[model samples]
Target: MSLLTRLLERNLRNSGAGARRLYSNHAEEESSATKHEFADEEPVQPPRHQKMATDQDWSAVWPGPRTFQPSVVPLPLRQGYTEKGAPPPSKFANAELMKIPNFLHLTPPAIRQQCEALKKFCTPWPKGLETLENCEKRFPIEIKSTDYCHALPTIRNPEARRVTLNIKLSDLKFDAHAKDKFLRLVGDRYNPNTGILTIVADRCPLRKQNYDYAMYLLTACYHESFVTESWESSKSEADMEYYSFERNKSKQSAEAIINWGQPVEEAKKLNADHGFAQSVEQLINEGENVYNLGKYKEEVLKLLNISK
Candidate 1:
C-alpha cells in the first residue's frame, strides 16, 4: 500500500478504538454511580401493617375517611371477580377496593370515642315528652327532610331541597264551617283515614326556603278556610253536601207524629228523641243498608215504647 493510504488506515483504527473506550468508560461509570447511590440508602422495610400489633389502636391510625391502602390495613381482604374458578383478587394493588368508601375509621371503638367526646354538648330529654302520644300532642307539626353523601363534584342534592310538613287536621281549631271549607280546599291532600294533611314543597332551591314555602302554604290555606264569602250565606238545604236531620223536613214530620194524641204540656214534653233522630239521619244518609235499617227499627221501637 502507499504511505498516505497506510497512514489514513492507522488513524481510522485509532479513532475507532478511542470511541469504543470512551463508550465503555461512560457505561461503567454510570453503573458504579447507580450502585453507590443505592448502597448509601437503607433497604426498604416491610409494610407498616406487618409490624403492627394485634391490639393496636386502629382509630389512631385511621382517624377519618380515606381511600383503602393495602399496606396500611393488616386484614387479608380480597375483592374483584375472576374467571376459571379462581379466587378473588387480593387487597394488594386492588383498584376495586380503592374505588369504594372505607368505613375503617368508624370502628366500634372509634364511634364510642366520638360519642363520648360529644356527650358534653348534648342536653337531657324533657320530662313530659316521654311517650310518642305526648310528643305529638305537645308538638303537632312534623317536618321531614333528607340529607345525602356521595362521591360527587357537588355536595348538594336536588332531592334534599324538598321539605315535607305533616300535621293532623284535628289538631287545628276549626269550626263547622271552617272545617268543611278546609276539607274542600285541601281535597286529596288531606287523608280522611288518618286525618293527616301533608304539604310537600320543592319549588325553592334550598331546604330552608322550601320549608318556609310549605309553612306559608299551610298558613294561607288555614286563613283562607276561615274566611266567609258572601255567597256562602245563600247555600240552601237543597244545596247542602250531606244530609242533616235538623235542617231537613224529617225533623218536622217526626215531631208532628210524636205529638199527635197528646195535650199541649205532654206534647211539649215529648220532643223527638236524640237516638231516634240520629238513626233516621243515618238511615237516610247511608242509604237502605241492612245495618241502618235494623238500627232505625230499634230506635223507632224504643221511641214509641212498643218494645215494652
Candidate 2:
C-alpha cells in the first residue's frame, strides 16, 4: 500500500532468517556440552540373583517362617494383581509375594529332625494304659474342655472357660433314696440309658476355676443326697414320680391273679411264673412300646395258662 509499510514487511522476513542463521552455532555448542556430560556414563545393569549349587542344603537357607524373598528362593514365582487378559508380574521383589509368610522351614526332613531333637524332653506312655477299657477303668471321671484361637484384638475366648465333668452313675455307689435325690438334683443332665451324669460349669472366668467349681458341685450333690431329711423319710410309694411296679401294689395284684386260691408261700415258690411277672412288670414300667406290649401279652398268657 504505502512505500514505508512495504519496506518494513520485507525487512522483518530478512531479520527472522538472519536470527536463525546466527543462533545455529550457539545451539550446536549447547547440545555438544550436554552430550559430553553423559558420554562417559554407561547404562545401568539389573540386579542378578546368585545361582544356587545343586548340592546346597535348603534347610540352612530358609530356617524359619519369614517374608518371601525372591532373591533367595530358587523357584520362579509370579504374583501381583493383573488386569483382565494381562499376565501377572514376575516375583522379583514383588510386594504381593513379600506380604505373606512362607513355610520353607517345615520341610519333611526338617520336621523329622526336630522331632528327634525333642524326643528326650517327652515322657514315655504309661505301660498299662494302652487299652481304652483299662484307661476308662482307671480314670472313671472324664473332664472335657474346649479351646479357641482367633486373629482379633483380644486373645481371650468366652467359651474356653466352660468345663464339663462326666462320670458313670454306677460308679457313684448310692442307696435307692440317695440315688433318687441325686437324680433329682442333677435334673436332665443324667442320661439314664447310658448311666452317665454330666455336670457343666462356666460361671468362673477361668477354665481351671470352672473345673474346680464343677468338682465341688459333684461333691456337694453326693454328700447332700446321703443326708436324708425328715420329709424324705416320710415319702411314700404314692409320692414317686417314676413308676416301679415291683415296689408297688401292681406286683402283688398280678401275683394274686396268676395264683388264685393258692397259698401265699406256694405262689412265692412259683419261680417260673414269678420271673414272667417280673418281666411283665419291667415292660409296663418302661412304657407300652408295641414290641414290649406283645412280649408282655405273651408273658401274661403263659402265666394264666390261656391257650389259643
Candidate 3:
C-alpha cells in the first residue's frame, strides 16, 4: 500500500475507538463572589498534592486564577511565532564569497556535506523513496543516478544504495552581465514517490554564503502529509522555492512574501524571462534594424518570422 493509503487507513481505524480524545478541555467551577482575604494561618503549611476526579495525584500549580483559566485558549496561538531559531543576521552579512571563481569548489567533505543537505531537503520521504523505476517521468528535468553513490548521501548517513547526482560546475548556466547567476541542476537523483525525477541543484553555493535567489524552483509543500517526517534539523519546508531576485522585489505586494511565503511569482518571472521570453524580446527589438540592412535585405527579412 502507498504510505498515504496506509496513513489514512491507520487514522480511520484509530478514529473508531481507543484513541485519545481528539480534543480535550478542562472546566473549572466558578465562585459567584470573591471571598475577602483571610487572616494568615498560624502555621503556613507546605502545599499539598491535589487529587480529584481524574484520580492522578498532582503537585499544585497555578497560572491565571483557576476559575479564570479558560476551558480552551481564547484564540488558537496558531500562526504566531512559536520560536524561530535562525543563525544570527550577521552570519549572512558576508556576500563577497561569490567573488571567488568556482565558488562551489568542493573538497571530499564539502561534496559529502552538500549531498547531505540535498537529502535533508528531500526528506519527509520517511523511508526515502523506495521504488524509483518510474520517477523520472514526472519532473520537468531528468535526474539519472550517478556513480558517486559510494561517497555521497546525507553526510549523517551515507547509504550504499543511495541516489547520486554528479553534475560538474561547468554545466551550470551563468552570464557575467546578468543579475541572476543560479546554476540550476539537472539533479541526478530520482524521487521514489510520484515516479517523477526533478532537478534541484545539489548545492546553491550562494545559500551557504547567505546570498538567496529571487527566481527559483517550486519545492515547498507545507500542510502536506509528510511534514512530520523531516529527517534533518532543518524542516522539509527548507526545500521550498528560494528566490532572492533584484527586479521582482519591488513588484511584490506585502502578501506575496510575508503571507504566501514562497518565491512563486518571482521565480515564474525569472525563468520566463531567461529561458524563452528573452530570446523573443531580443528578436523584437533587433528585427527592424537587422531587416533594413543592405545585402541581407527585403527578401530575407520577409522570409523570416519578423513578417509572421
Give TM-scores for every candidate, taking all chains together and pairing residue i with residue i: 0.74, 0.62, 0.15
Per-residue lDDT tens digits of candidate 3, residues 94-207?
333212222123445555656886996684753434556333222223333322222223323322223323222333333432211122232333333443334333343332
Q: Candidate 1 vs. truth: CA RMSD? A: 6.5
Residue 290, model 1: Cα distance from true site in angstroms:
5.2
What would the per-residue lDDT of candidate 2 be over residues 47-135, giving only the tens digit for each residue? 33456776677777887877777778777788778899998898886987776656778988778888999999999999999999999
**What's model 2's lDDT at 75?**
76
Higher-ranked by lDDT: 1 or 2: 1
lDDT of 1 at 77: 98
Weakest 10 consecutive residues of candidate 3 by summed lDDT: 25-34
Against the true structure, candidate 1 reaches a TM-score of 0.74
TM-score for predicted model 2 compared with the true structure: 0.62
Number of the top-ranking candidate, with TM-score as the measure? 1
Ranking by lDDT: 1, 2, 3
The local distance difference test score of model 1 is 0.90
Per residue, candidate 1 scores C-alpha lDDT tens digits across 1-308 of 69999999999999999999999999999999999999899988999999999999999999999999899999999988899889889999899899877789999999999999999999999999999999999999999999987657676889999999999998999987888888888889999899999999999899999999999989999999999989889999888887877778888888777778777685365677888888987887779898999999998888777863
